[model samples]
Target: MKKLFLLLLFTVVVLVACASPYDPAPQLLPSYVKNVYVRPVVNNTNQYGLEDKFTKAIIDEFMRDGRLSVVTTEEEADGVVVCEIKRYVLQPLTYDENMVTEQYKLWVLINVFFIDKHENVTLWAEPNMEGIQIYADSVKGGFGGMTEEEAREYIWEKLARDIVKRTIKGFGSTGGISERKVQD
Candidate 1:
């Protein structure tokens, strides 16, 4: 009985020593930041009207999340999200026997930053946030595929979700391009 008791005690000790303590919900954002304002997107690329659509998408995403209030003005917000559309590249990925493009890859790159309104400082900046979609060109008759506009809408949705997730879930939650290779 004595030996059994010691063995049980030793097992319990070892188990306790090997166990790791983890907090299920580690606080990622400051408590004071409850409202965020998404500034109008600035499009640096030559793609026209991309800023408006992307800006609306991000704002809609934040509203849909409902975790933080979306404010119209900077003064009313505790945080501000600034976005710049850096690059838009659409290229033919696959071609048919007649040299007709069948599939195309559309990639959009943007730089996003979260700024602390109170401190007037950027908390985080994702410089190479990118969204890409490869699809069959319906115009090229690739089995009734999607149009460029449709593919762009898909990209916007995904990037918007990623932006919202990054904001709500904190750093390292979403992945983006590490280094930009887009040249002038």
Candidate 2:
């Protein structure tokens, strides 16, 4: 019994010594981004209204993160985020010529640029931040296709969330927060 107790005590001591303590580091923000400027998104695509949707989404992302202060104009900001709508397409769904169904998929593509003014650097430029959402054809049949306005609303919300999440993760990986900011 004495030997067993000693062995157990020794095992506990070893286990305690082997365990590593958590040491939190200091939080750090991006070196180049002190202030962010969100430009009015330009729509260069043939599809109408996409430009507005993308622009609003990007701005919403900046607001949600609340990490960097946003500026109205690029000249006033330390970093500028410029975006463009590249494509917006809704393909029709038809089972046959005689019997047409109301269902469609909406696709949207946007280009995003993060530029640093002071450093004259382009931190990130992605030409393809794209998303797709499906909508039914008619409200009555429970299979109705999405109207243009409805599709816009759906796509905008989805794009905003996606852009916000991706940007936050990217910023974090690039040292958006200091070690001290990380919760235990």
Candidate 3:
């Protein structure tokens, strides 16, 4: 009986080890959502012109992706992408011996929603979507560092890519902030 039990345990272990890894297929957006209108991004932070740059980045990303037609008006679109810049933070990550900031971290937080205009329902909502970058100061570090504007541009590109991926690939591509932080 002991030999039989050991054999059974070994068989179970072998079967488990031989099992194929599960990979979930990416979920695509609804077939009806062939076109989208990106509303002008709203900036809540004191930073100036961030809305324009971010909005342009998103538009450019959609155009580059070629998966969805970008429409000029909501009426012409099957879906609408709503974006709002909620927060922007720049902090010193490391300081030099002189107490000067040598390295900095930039963070941009946003809320994104893709609504099915025909159904009058939001198909997907990403609240507190964020893009972050860390770099050394150009004057203090060995490697030439990016200016604040350059850092902002980098963040815009990252966010635009994420937004596009979330729209085209649907769930599990990216994670938003904790649900507890999101308010109605």
Instruction: Please identify which of the two predictions, 1 or 2, would achieve the higher lDDT against the true structure.
Output: 1
lDDT of each: 0.84, 0.67, 0.85
Q: Candidate 1 on 6-57: residue-level lDDT in tens?
A: 9999999989878965435432666789999999999998889999998999
TM-score of 3: 0.81
At residue 121, what lDDT does model 3 achieve? 67
Q: Estimate each model's TM-score.
A: 0.77, 0.66, 0.81
lDDT of 3 by residue, 116-167 (tens): 7767767778889999999877766549797778888999999999999988
Pick out the ten consecutive residues of candidate 3 with the lowest summed lDDT: 175-184
lDDT winner between candidates 1 and 3: 3
TM-score of 2: 0.66
Best by TM-score: 3
Off by over 4 Å in 1: 1-27, 172-184
Model 1's C-alpha root-mean-square deviation from the true structure amounts to: 7.3
Separately for all candidates shown, the number of backbone clashes (residues 3 or more apart, or on different chains) is 0, 18, 0
1 or 2, greater by TM-score? 1
Of 2 and 3, the candidate ranking higher by lDDT: 3
